[model samples]
Target: MTGALTVRVLSGLTELSLTPPLARAIWGEDDGPEDPVLLQVLQRVGGLVAGALDPQGQVWAYLVGLPTARADTQHSHRLGVHPDVRRQGLGEQLKRFQQTWCLERDVTRVTWTFDPLLLANAHLNIHRLGAVAVAYLPNYYGAMAGINAGVPSDRFEVVWPLGGAHTHAPWPMGPAVDPLRDDLPADLPGALALCVPRDYYRLLREDPALALEWRQRSAPLFSRLFQAGHTLVDVDLSRGQYLFRRTAC
Candidate 1:
């Protein structure tokens, strides 16, 4: 319509991420707060929100500054995808859009957190997307949701080299962001965290086949993040994902 998938800054009401139930479902994952999505809507939209939309209408995603932080240049933040639209390439487009946003604004770098145990994400962020992982927090969340059924609260802090691109397609994405600031900040812009329910660990401990799959799914990239030099900061207990940051040294 406009171009090869339009990119723009919007206020509210974009993509499945904005949908009330879907947002909550995604946040709850399998068992988060019944209204987790409400928090997603209020916080993400409360401030400036940006998104990317593809011609297929297959995806919707958003980015914004951390909620509690005063909102500044150095510690930029992001969250994305319409969840259902995931595994369809919309996530990649959203990431590219965020990259463009960071570059255009002269922001230093971007940061996010995820469950280190979630093998799927490990692949997406590390092996495929070119981000590196640092910090490993244990039980970051209190197993409040069903999704947290049997996994430890372990989470990884991942950072990407913004300002440039270093990805392949199909198996690899393109356009890695430029290397972030040459120097590190005394403190990062914001914090990253996640939690899974306690029961999920049962599946991992009992299902050798599934746990094998999880390991196979994530190992390659997890190792790569380590090679890339992202560093760990703080790790806690609970059960999902924690936070991480790119390191200067």
Candidate 2:
């Protein structure tokens, strides 16, 4: 963690092999690394496999993307940063690297899924990077292990347009709904705010039952709102709420 960090395109068996242990380090022992063989094949097929190396040439962060059905779109499958070196902006750095890589290949959009309750990720993907969260997939991955163990794998499918900044106001505002409460507003003229746990991981560790209750209670509400034509616009982390607005008809 001493010298300047350098992001580089990773290829071949040796460089690809470094990811499994790094994935374990970042996501816990239950985390399984993507197969190096498949990664090599992906590289051969115009996919991307890249990493951030520190002064010691250790992979501190890595990102993986694959070509999707649309030639101009890519699905970012995995991104991980070493726990000890987190909060140093490594995640964003890797994503900027991804942005340039995608642009070079004529890819106009990059898509990914993330846990909706994770505030830090919400801040990064929606606020900082300007990705749009469009769909709510409940139990998208079924049961999961590692840090995701014991939680239903609900995810927000986001699309990051590589062409320019994401659509939607950077800081949206309107009426708010506290999901912990049972009542939900029937009508709103402007954007709607939905509360999220400020520190979900801590809540999971300290009060697991409450964490599960929060997910179970919030899932259906999010689904209903999205079905009502609300598109997530921004996340107000300071207030612990996600901003959503009705899609223009």
Candidate 3:
């Protein structure tokens, strides 16, 4: 069982200092923390930098957001939960806190990006947060380190609508895309199931070649689906598939 958590809107150097160490703990050495100067600036300019503290007073999770060109929206840049406290709902709690924070400030939408192959992230971002993947970005960041090392940085840009009722369309029964196959479907379907590895990190560790192959194969497929007016609305975590439905352009 998890202990009580206090989610607070963090400010000042002291509270914010807790984030850097926590980030390194969660993301490894190469993926370090957000710059302190940037964090302070975000707080000063209507952005959010918040943390979740466990009962022992340790900051276990942190989230950061920045104002966007559209005043009604914000881009959530980073969210990290310490490895020790993961899978205990702390991530969801921090997001819910972000939702409340955004709603109060008249921000109605939150946007972020994540790797399309990560099952846990896909489940949380699509299934748990009610976000829609509007675009497919291939090699978005060019290169990276730590867990993401040696892999192309493809991402799904998603937006989570806040301050109102939101829902993803029901999962569709449609054609499936075989991840292992080299071939691509000739045409788009009304609904599509794009399967991914159940555990991408394992594949990356054991067989980096196969992992890179998956990225190369699915990159074009995702781009084509989005081009054909399909939006990623849901994910089947158990089956490790993303559910995309074609919509009118």
Candidate 4:
């Protein structure tokens, strides 16, 4: 996948023309289209807008981001990879490109939010890219559609600190445990582990009430832990656990 694809920065009208279709392809027809005018403004003002193109000149993935209130930080607003070409490392390639694009402009950190129940995203962000979640937003976007339609828009706000020591550490490992039934530890270890359902989307389709119940159960726990100064450092995919560590102030 990497050999055949090229990742490049998009500008002006190009960002506008390409992003909406790519977003729809990834998130389905109900996915809200990002405002092209906003994207153009962001592109002109040194924000990062990039895409992955296949050999045939078709965009298979794209990332949209903008400078945050902090001069040295960027907020990655959206990242989408076309359904047909997913699981091919295109998402990671786009992220690496985004990182390089930001670092070139002296930006030191990039932040984004992701649904905590999506284990694949958890593995990619927390485990692969070395991002840490510092806050949890319950029903963050109110009610969203497409992949996020049924469930509440609960999210984990993660920060990826460029040039940090944590980025270089190897991915962590943990014993496999069923997230649905495993007993959560009462005392916080130097690092603690918590779980999300293995297939939350399916759970939503088959049992919507149970899905909401999971959200009700998790929101308070995540909020309390994050407020207590614990940061989510990694995700163990085999066991479906999101690992959090006590960070020294």
Candidate 5:
């Protein structure tokens, strides 16, 4: 760890003065702390990683690379915002920085996963930026240990089509005019439904009942669509929820 505010790439091991508390501060306490010991071990193990800096030589953010295997075809580790300065658009900034970093390295794709139930994150991933929530992993984390420990940790694996603009099938475009009316519920006996990250989290917080209701209600439609041969790729975080545009039928 060198001076204040320099995005230095460390060759071996560097302590950026950032800790796990900082990570918990922003993303909630359960996601794991940004501990130096843990990070050192992780970096040593392998991954493209970086530590954020401030003017006076203090670490502000921590960026890690999921080097071994990307969440999808491309993309490395999950991005985390310091608990203190989250919502200041720092996470997005970090991601864009990572995206560019990946592209420069000849990595054409980048992917990450998130709880589709959490609405704010959903908005952050989809609406403000352009990411997709194509795959839904039920109980992805098994049992989350931190802040979100009480709830189910099912995650939506989001993919950033950094390779290029994704070629989507001609599924009817949305603002669906009337999703409730035009989009008739497909018949899916055993299927999982899409949940916007932030919104889903909010439901867990604001109305656990509603979240429960959605899990059951969406099963049929989501399953039906998939069974009918519709593919939910790069979900539309463009609006608020995990809106998947059927790329193939």
Candidate 6:
């Protein structure tokens, strides 16, 4: 499955049927199928359910979103790309396509929750896509399996503004600090940096105890910073750092 990919809306049962296997393959779990009834309802209610197909008509990636109470906003529910085609810019392309799909339907903002400890995802959402983390949710999913099995399902609620201007900030040149390893700076500037493990999944597999320790350690820090009017606005993937800025009230 190579060459130019085509993205289109997945409407009827036939197209939506692919969501379950795709999701299972992406997460490496049999965590039940995506509810077809719900998908039907969402499709009927102006929601966005689309997938990207390779040249041979194989669905390689998919994105699902639902309309929010506000007409101009949509809640991004899921995005998955086949492991084989990842890092080929297909995930980013699917996201860009989703943004365009939302804009065409008069939606300007998209919201989603993602694990804060996943540095790669953090980079993709914040630095690459310009989404801002607005809140920290502790144990958001209660309990789970697959990639998120052991640790607390803490998440960062991100907001992506489709029509707003996004400015790319310069990377921080200060000494990098790992919250899991080093003491946090006593005097934080207008901007502060926190680092997560480059391979959280490996940490989970090799040291489940340490993985849980990371969640226990970072949750309060992120919660406190968010309460103090700080927002995660960018990430430096090279250093596995998440940058938070004090937002003006």
TM for every model, in the order presented, reads 0.51, 0.94, 0.93, 0.88, 0.68, 0.93
Model 6 Cα shift for residue 149 (angstroms): 0.5
lDDT of 2 by residue, 100-119 (tens): 99999899889999998999
Per-model CA lDDT versus the true structure: 0.47, 0.86, 0.85, 0.80, 0.55, 0.85
Decoy 2 TM-score against native: 0.94
Worst 10 residues of 6 by lDDT: 28-37
> How many clashes (backbone atoms < 3 Å, residues ≥3 apart in a chain or on different chains) does model 1 have?
47
Q: Give lDDT tens digits, candidate 6, residues 1-249.
A: 768878888768777877888888888784555776688788898988888886676778898898989999999888888888888787788789889989998899999999989898888899889999999999998888776787888999999999877897665667766667776566666788888888887899899999998888888788988988889999888878888888987
What's the candidate order when arranged by decreasing lDDT? 2, 3, 6, 4, 5, 1
Ranking by TM-score: 2, 6, 3, 4, 5, 1
Clashes of 3: 0
List residue ranges in candidate 2 displaced over 4 A.
166-175, 188-190
Off by over 4 Å in 6: 171-173
TM-score of 4: 0.88
Which 10-residue window in model 2 sums to the lowest lDDT?
165-174
Clashing pairs in 4: none
lDDT tens string, model 3, 73-180? 999999888887789888888889999999999999999999889888888888888888999999998898877888999999998998666576776665567767
Better of 2 and 5 by lDDT: 2
lDDT of 1 by residue, 41-72 (tens): 65464333455555764225544544334232
Please identify model 4 stretches exceeding 4 Å from their true place.
Answer: 1-3, 167-187
Candidate with the larger lDDT of 1 and 5: 5
* Candidate 6 TM-score, true structure as reference: 0.93
Query: Residue 45 CA error for candidate 6 (Å)?
Result: 0.5
For model 3 the local lDDT of residue 222 reads 87
